[model samples]
Target: MADEVKLLGVVGSPFVCRIQIALKLKGIEYKFVQEDLANKSDLLLKYNPVHKKVPVFVHNEKPISESLVIIEYIDEVWKNNSIFPSDPYHRALARFWAKFIDDKIVTPSFKSVFTVDEKEREKSIAESTEALQILENELKEKFFGGKEFGFVDISAVFIAFWIPLFQDIIGLKLFTAEKFPNLYKWSQEFLNHPTVKEIMPPRDPLFSFFKGIHDKLHSSSK
Candidate 1:
């Protein structure tokens, strides 16, 4: 019997996109169930009761929560296309950078772009720029995995795709080519990949979605 594989996710979520990218890279056949996060379904609550979040990966009726965990699970199960390096040390390094990207880059960058308070936003922008610089310096190759799209690249899916939308929406330029040449170049290359291109959210609608949030937050802050 064939395995039952399903992904519970919301549209335009970068975390969810990470799973989609990994699945596509590994050539996995699965079902994508779109979720309305505002009114989360019973399945979502049942699968991930603690977070009640999307991007719950279900394989053979077993549910997996968290994007990074699901990604590692997918990599382990599907051996054909290995996402992490073969060497244990390299794999550990990749994981380290991924964690750093999530903890240091993602939070500050999002706040730098979306926060309503001017002072807080400035602080976030400084921290975000510092994080980007570290990432840029670490990037010594075309892609994070040297030449191939691998673990670290997948971990940084947001920096490549979503951040551009955020920048455009708010007219804030924290990740410019002049400021971080390597990362800027990496983002362009990453976006051009066929698999990455397939799953990226369309600019107009996604922009509108983000804009709505941006306006709402700013208005509420006032």
Candidate 2:
């Protein structure tokens, strides 16, 4: 287990943070390589030639891209702690939630939160809030995936971490203590866990980074 491990990721991406959390949870030591999204590293290009995205996991000498793929890879390589369900059905359910968040929640919510137009913003917000509510229902009494911390937990972990920051920045309360009481409280629990707490990025810094990303995205579009 002496092979060199290096992670090339942009500091700001929640996707990248997902990879970081996976590595930390597994107690895997690796060199952290900060990448400039504006000016990508040769390693990122060389590794993930297709999407050329960050949060690329380099194990030994091979590179793996996509946060979820990286997470699964990390879990497989380091067996000290497993983050997925044991039963076949449970594993599929957990994977369903993860894919739902990726395909259903994250992108739509992001669009809603960052739109400049009020009407468009409202529409996006409605869609985002509906998605959040659906998630709230799913999380009614469940804590973590099947038995404990696993794939679903790791997959949606960013929602707990970034929602607060995004709420502040967007000036809209998508999640509320009264309205989404379970999720609100669950967030506190998840964020306070020693493992999550240690690896979690500062809220202020994440907000600042997201603001930069929002600006950067808008800047290039216009």
Best by TM-score: 1
What TM-score fits each model? 0.97, 0.89
Clashing pairs in 2: none
The TM-score that candidate 1 achieves is 0.97
**Clashes per prediction?**
0, 0
Alpha-carbon local distance difference test for all models: 0.90, 0.77
Model 1, 126-218: lDDT tens digits are 886788888988999999898898999999999998887888887877778898889999999999999899988788888898899898898
Ten consecutive residues with minimal summed lDDT in candidate 2? 140-149
lDDT of 2 by residue, 1-222 (tens): 597999998765778888877888888889999988789878788988999888888989998888888888887777788887657887778778888877666776677657766687677677767877887888845465643567777777767877667777767777788888877777777777788778776778778877887777667668
RMSD of each: 1.1, 2.5
Off by over 4 Å in 2: 140-142, 212-222
